[model samples]
Target: MHLFADMLARVHAAAAAVLGPSADLTRIVVEPPRDPSHGDMATNAAMVLAKDAGQKPRDLAEAIAAKLLADAKVEKVDIAGPGFINLTLKGEVWPDALRTVLEQGKGYGRGTVGAGKKVNVEYVSANPTGPLHVGHGRGAVFGDALASLLVAAGYSVTREYYINDAGAQVDVLARSAFLRYREALGEDIGEIPEGLYPGDYLKECGAELAADYGDRLKAMPEAEWLPIVRLRATDMMMAEIRNDLARLRIVPEVFFSERSLIEGELPDPFSKEPPKPLVDVVAETIAALREAGHVYEGRLPPPKSGNLEDWEDREQTLFRSTEFGDDVDRPLLKSDGSYTYFATDIAYHKSKFDRGFADMIDVWGADHGGYVKRMQAAVKAVSGGKGQLDIKLVQLVRLLRNGEPVKMSKRAGDYITLREVVDEVGKDAVRFDMLYRKNDAVLDFDLAKVIEQSKDNPVFYVQYGHARGKSIFRTAAEQGVLPADPAALQRADLVRLTDSGELSIIRKLALYPRMLEAAALAHEPHRIAFYLYELASEFHAQWTRGGKESPHLRFIIQDDPQTTQARLALVQGIVTVLASGLDLLGVEAPEEMR
Candidate 1:
């Protein structure tokens, strides 16, 4: 159904026949020309094939153009600047493309780009200590959209969230909840002590504790009270995190707990038999790695930025990450006999690989950029070079209001939560605007601009296109010109859609499948956002032109029901594609936003 791909296949065959079937065709790329006047599509095959064919580039271009002109799809072929061959397809081919779009509908952009490979996407693995902030929201949205994109490209995807419940952060959470519990018992707890969370969200945990146990836990020792409070608070915080994710339309297929990795015999709460702990499983994997010479005792230098005042130079259990291209070896254990964060991460990734995931993608914050090389090296070590790990670092978002930066104090309570952003501008605006730029580049999310109901706002522009398309259907219904059924619209005389404005929209619609494949293969969901904006721009421009020049060319026609149905079919195609793209980004395709 992709005209571009079909045209490229014909060119590939012709080029192979001319080059005597031995030429390498890997570098051949057929894409839409930057300038529409160049042609419907352009290819640099002649230039790429010239050196191998031992001929001047233009000579090869003319030769290839002669072969392409013989194909029925190529109505005209022009040799442009620097041996670029531009092919203008026949007009009839475009209506067929629209027919394909209507026939496929939601499945229009589906492609087998990934070839059914198993990919594991680990994202939003926030610590079970508190609510997710705006930073975590970016990663969550990026990762979830990436997963959906891969699925659209025919890859089996596992959406996963890693719970950091086995770390010092959870311990801190335990202490903080214990303080709140004391306060709930009417104890006048002074200013929150150091090394404990001070967020007001913890008051509910204290209240729940007070309701469950009147004074039974008041006299308990720290050892007994700490575990109970930690478990209870972690559970509550994770539930809150899940709800927050739901608000943003992100749901993970798997929630891997870090605490499950420790070695112990514990009864399964739902079953009678005791299950083996994950710590033993990780230890066994480490032993296998050690047998393969990837683990050893080593000392690591202190990190460059953070203050490590308690730093003691000593050899510790380390992963041989340096052998696999890491800058330095990483320690698995700290001096106090506790596992470092890297250790648990390594175990978690190893578990993913053991589950038969050879392709893994990790979405982390920009601050974790330094850890990418080591994590990749660990994956190579544990998987014995059979697995690949791709780490995507999402840069920090600078929130702005009315052109001024919003200052957030992590130590104080003056920070914005993900829920706040979602509530203020709405989930659709937040998701689309967050993903409208490249993930590696810092994004300036201006609150005022996103919420503005104007064409200058891209979120509104694209959604307005969808709404306008639906509005055409409403207008047709009001004029007694609505299509009797979807099939009637599908079978509308699309040949009537031959005007420049109508054909341009069809051309944009035709690019969706190929665009999806490219965006998915590149692991860039932002490309979809950018494409939606451009498509909406095309649709809106055409609508505005029709308003001034030819009102009959507009979507609805009261005088001619057949033309109205055909035009409505075109509008339906636009709406289908916009909705599909927005769905991949987890954004809403709003019918009305005013």
Candidate 2:
């Protein structure tokens, strides 16, 4: 249903006919003009086709433009800048787009980019040791928005959070909570001993422990009480984390615990199959790979920089990740016989493949960049080359307030919590600001800028656009010019919306479907955020243009109810698109933000 896709199809058919069995139109690309003055759309078909056709680029562009000009959709075609064919479509197509936008409402941008395939998006798999900091916030927002974008583009997506509760980090968290529990029992516990978590957030876990067990736990030894305290404390921390995620409007469909991967029974509980815990799954996977000649016993070199006085050379179980494109073979097991984190991760992904999700995406921080290739190798080897893994690395977020950096140190227990930021600037500001920049680019989130209710800020700019459309509907109602029913608005004589300002707004509305498909296919939600800003800017400019030019161009018309209803229909389309785009980014499209 995308107008651009339809136009491109027509161009492709015509180009194929002209070339007559000699040309491949797969390389032809149609894109919006970088400069609006160029045209509504531009294509590099001629430039791309000329090299193979043995003709000069300009000569080929002229020929393509001649063929396209005969089409009913093409109002005008111009050959520009060597070989680009710029096309201006007829104005009649725009009102139909407006009607479509209004009819579909929030579903206007939905598309079939994923073709009903099942994809698993694993993100925000933070350790249950502590609260998510600003760094985690970046991945959380990017992953959640990317999942939503995939769903909009027709993928059956499973949003997953892999909890790292099986690692040494949880042990530290348990010990930290144990200290707090003792302190809660009125024991004179000295200064939060070194190498333990020092965050005040664990204070509540301590209080909960006291409420559950009173002073009875104080008499128990470390080994006796540690497991009970750890389980309860970890559960409490996870609950707090869930609450924090709720504040940011992020909800993962599956909270897959790393501990559960090893502790739980196998999928076929009644079958003779052995209980495949995460660790056992990894061991079995490695054994199977060895049988297939993909796993080998190997020795790893010492670290490049650190002192290796304690480093002992020994053969270890290794995955031949280099054969599948990793830089080197990866160690599946450490020298201590315990499975490395990567080993468990391989089993985790194999589980995803076993469950029939061949397409997988993992959203990780930039620090995890080194891990991507090895993970992809594991997915390929385990799935027998049937499954694919796409890892999106989200760069860091620099938190700022009033142009000054917000300094934080996790080691010092002074890191800014995601919940605190959500509370301070509100969820809409946090989500939009986090997604305003590309995921791989460092984002500068200025608290003051996000909360500002002005055009200078994108969140406010888009929200104001939706609110302005609502304001017009309210004004039309007050003037007794509002449509009596949805059908009345649908039957609007949209031809009256022929003014250049109105037509430009309608053109922007027409771009939503195509933009959604592009963003979803690229796995980039920032594109939606950027598109909403541009759409809002166009609507605002059109509204402001009417103020300076014809006052009759205003949305409300006291004496002309037909024209007023038509403009109101256009306004409704704009609001629907703005709200829909914001919804994908997890931002609020407020009716009135004042």
Candidate number with greatest lDDT: 1
Worst 10-residue lDDT window, candidate 1:
262-271
Reference-based lDDT, residue 529, model 1: 95
Judge candidate 1 against the unseen true structure and give its global Cα lDDT, from 0 to 1. Answer: 0.86
lDDT of each: 0.86, 0.85
Pairs clashing within candidate 1: 261-278, 261-279, 262-279
Flag regions of model 1 displaced more than 4 Å: 20-27, 44-62, 79-84, 263-278, 299-312, 407-412, 560-562
lDDT of 2 by residue, 543-580 (tens): 88768577888888778888888999998988988999
* Residues 1-594, model 1: lDDT tens digits: 577678778889878877878898878888899999988999999999999899998999998899999988889999988799999999889888888888889888888879999999999898988788888999999999999999999999999998888767898998898889889999999999977899888999998988887777778877667767877898899999999899999999999887777643234233466565435656776677778888887676886756688455798887888899998777777778877888877888899999999999999999999899999999998888999999999999889998998766442376778887888888888889889989999988888899898877889999999998888777778777886677678888998997888899999999898888888878999999999999999898878877857887777767777787788889889999999999999988878657
Number of colliding residue pairs in model 2: 2
